[model samples]
Target: MDLLATQQCIKISQEIGWTEKRTIETTYEMKLFNDYLLVKKEKFPVTSIFDISFRKKSQTNDIGFLYLHTNSGVRTYFIKEEPFSLIEAYEKLKLERPELR
Candidate 1:
């Protein structure tokens, strides 16, 4: 996993309601173990993750967001700059998680 990108994801998790202090201190990898997408500050548990979608760019010069559809609602993550890392992670999940495929 890209440490920098994963760290960015953790930071965003904190901004978006991740309150677990212990988790924040832990090193993260984009590993889909069991049913959760394990990250540093938060775990996207499959139970809570309803779907995953990619948004179209709002403008030609702009990138778009990766939409994490959850039980609560869709959470948008800025991923347009270099999205392949997260895409690979999700693809791994899809391969391992038959239901998601």
Candidate 2:
């Protein structure tokens, strides 16, 4: 599988302690392949993937949710920033290589 694009997602750990001001941020990669989407370690095949969506971080929302809708189920991943690049790349991949989908 050819790597098409990758999105960096940051998850800040919440802490409630005076000893540590803040916990270290965790990093995760959302990768788009020729026929699959890999979120960290788990991989979802393109054929099973139905749609991908995102929600911006707001006062109510801590970190936005990157919703991956698939045949199995909807998986939500916390993302610190907007994943416009990943979305664009995926769309382009679909346009350029329809067979991959």
Candidate 3:
């Protein structure tokens, strides 16, 4: 896996939602292992940041990366690529993190 490319994809994913086209392009070479999409980078590699995965529920169509900023201790905004209803996304997140409820 290309580290630069994957980082770029992550940055973009954080800024905008991961569309079907972007997902295919970013994870084209990545191997799906269990729940995470595995990407191996060689140069300047600092572990995997995009290792987390999510399930697409029928209630939500909005898809994007969930970034947890450790340094700032704040949750970043969901970058949306295509137009989608965010209500379902919010519900899904709440369901995933029951503590937040």
Give the number of the best model, judged by TM-score. Answer: 2
Per-prediction count of colliding residue pairs?
0, 0, 3
Consecutive 10-residue window with the lowest summed lDDT within model 1:
2-11
Residue pairs in steric clash, candidate 1? none
**Candidate 3 global CA lDDT score:** 0.32
What are the Cα lDDT values of the candidates?
A: 0.54, 0.80, 0.32
> What lDDT score goes with residue 27 in model 2?
88
Give the 10-residue window scoring lowest on summed lDDT in candidate 2: 56-65
Candidate 2 segments whose C-alpha is farther than 4 A from its true place? 12-24, 57-62, 97-101
lDDT of 3 by residue, 7-71 (tens): 11222332345653443333222222222233344121122222233333344435455343222
lDDT tens readout by residue for model 2, 9-61: 77677776867666778888999998789886787878787777899766543
Query: Which runs in model 3 stand beyond 4 Å of their true positions?
Result: 1-60, 79-101
Residues 79-98 of candidate 1 have per-residue lDDT tens digits of 43445555666666667767
What is the TM-score of each predicted model, taking all chains together? 0.46, 0.74, 0.21
